[model samples]
Target: MKACISRWASEPFRVFFPLGMLAAIAGVMMWPLLYTGKLGFYPGEAHSRVMIEGFMGAFVIGFLGTAFPRLTGNASWSCGELVWMILLWATTVASALNGQVLVADTVFATLLLLLSSGMIGRWACGNRDTPPPGFVMALAGILGGALAAGLLAWNQKYPLGFTSYQFAKLWLNQGFLLLPLMGIAPYLLPRFFGMESGHSFHDSPTPPPGWWPRFTASVICALLIAAGFALEAFGWSLVGHVLRATVILAWFASETPVFRRGKLSCTPGNVARFAVVALILGTAAAGLWPLARVGSLHLFFAAGLGLAVLAVATRVVLGHGGRHDLLVGRIVWLRIAAGLLVLAAATRMTSDFVPAVRVSHHIYAAWIWAAGGSVWLIFVSRYLGRGEEEPS
Candidate 1:
């Protein structure tokens, strides 16, 4: 048991990815339980909290914890750090499950602080390579998450004014996830599409001459994204949405091979492309149909960010496990999972637009999302610790 855990600790993703998937399952399951009268509370806030802070947050921790150390040539997360982080994550999930939003958010803030401190510590003092320039946005996203959590916890104790509340929600729902996804995509997605990423690390201790300029660009983009969120919070929804979407599209086009035809078009890469489309469309839809904003945002949450995270997680697991063959091919299970998520997003949107069928559609969407998460988890979990070992 000790040896098995040591191996898992060596690669944080081996543990946290599965935990994130399970949190996603649990988060979506709340709706079904509520509509069926199995749950006593409405679970709206709790569901959102769990999905963002518990589900998405776990992936952030896993991927960054696993990748950051290597990126900076620092040590991997110690076993103690891994254990404490997992415990805190589990507590946050449990608190959210019990409808303790304040508790959940507070715990989640602490977790983010812990994660940020470790990564920042490595970046500041460690030897070897610098992280990608886009990581400036990634760091901003992490800090945004912590701030969002703190705001939420405070709101639970004292009512934030309507604008303040909206700002908090926007930061939590869109800013935290969107920033990190865009930040990481430039550095990671090119590889998925069989294109060379220009952000590769060098052997020299000092960063290359042009690194700071790229970092400055990332900082400017991050500020633009935050400004967009502020605009939305101040009731300029359409302007904000358009600005955010345009910034993301422009950044993606500049930083990634998103517009170019890559040599490869595999499952993860294809899904990632779909995610980008969904993200832009969904953001625009939220502005275009304010009355159905809830449903439109599902496209961003369930299909856009959710699918993107799974796709990246899939590639990470397969690549690390030496299952290069799987990465190049269309994995049938992943296709099914992606299809299910799309359906769930559509169903959720339909529920918002058509009031008569809202309850039933909500239940259906929840179950569909849960089913999709299960399919993804089942497929990826098999390769977790199997590194380079052929399946029997």
Candidate 2:
């Protein structure tokens, strides 16, 4: 028992946790949107989103624990922090899932508040190599906690002085989840195409193939996303438009090095190439702005999240695992899987936009999401076995 506990306390467990969380996220995404006709579960939209929120909290904890050492030259965080953080996350997830259990829900929400605040406070001492845009982003975790608190209010006749439409709903949605993700996400963006990562696979800071100015451009992309999401939440819709446009440009700019180097045909290389195209098309859709309607958001997700993020996560995992010394093997199919996810998202998007498509939304969403989830799982396994070439 002691031996098992000791083994579990180490890095492999840490790695596996995020994989599990990501899988859960994919499952939550794919889960059927059924209805009991009850106010809460009728469309089941909130249920899925809340579950995704749980996965996000897990990702944040895992990300911070994994990345902080690389960035700050600190020792990996102690086991105690992991226990506390994960427990808090679990509680928060439970609270969201079972809002009727008022005591459990309230306790869990408070735990999230405490844990998230502690995370920001601990990282308060961190100094940045770049301008540290992620710092403010990370601080938004406290806001997420507040959102969790808002969720708990469903039990108390909704009498917390925060109405669902007002402070409880929209602000919490944007402030808590989207904003802090902005910080850690910059570190995460490059992985989709087997690029440089802090994942301990590639020797430290060695630039990936097919790129000259990937680093600078990646920073710009991250900043654009941060500003876009933040301004959108703050109700500065025009500013959101400008920031999103900047993201489109930055996305294209980041890929210039890849296109120039011309390895653009290899499996992983092609994924990055395709991602750039997706972004370009996505940006054109964005040109429609509010006139663009929800269909445009689907295009954005399909292109940006599905194509780009899929490439980033898989590629980063591969590079960090050290799988591509001569060349990273055929991971392009994974991107295809991601594209399938986009296809699924696009279906729902079409339904949202065109009344004719609404009837098939649930079934369409599930299949595409399953494909995306499966491919990501494949990457996780591939990296675990043979991905890491050298320890940094």
Query: lDDT of all predictions, in order shown?
Result: 0.88, 0.49
How do the predictions measure up, each by TM-score? 0.97, 0.64
> Whole-model lDDT, candidate 1?
0.88
| Shift in Å, residue 362, candidate 2 | 2.9
Top lDDT prediction, candidate number? 1
lDDT of 2 by residue, 274-345 (tens): 655555455455444555444565554444434544454455455556765423556456756766767776
Over the stretch 260-289, how does candidate 1's per-residue lDDT look in tens digits? 788898988888888888888888898889
Task: Give the number of the best model, judged by TM-score.
Answer: 1
Error of 1 at 283 (Å): 0.4
Worst 10 residues of 1 by lDDT: 198-207
Stretches of candidate 1 exceeding 4 Å from the true structure: 389-392
TM-score, prediction 1? 0.97
Q: Output the lDDT of residue 6, model 2.
A: 35
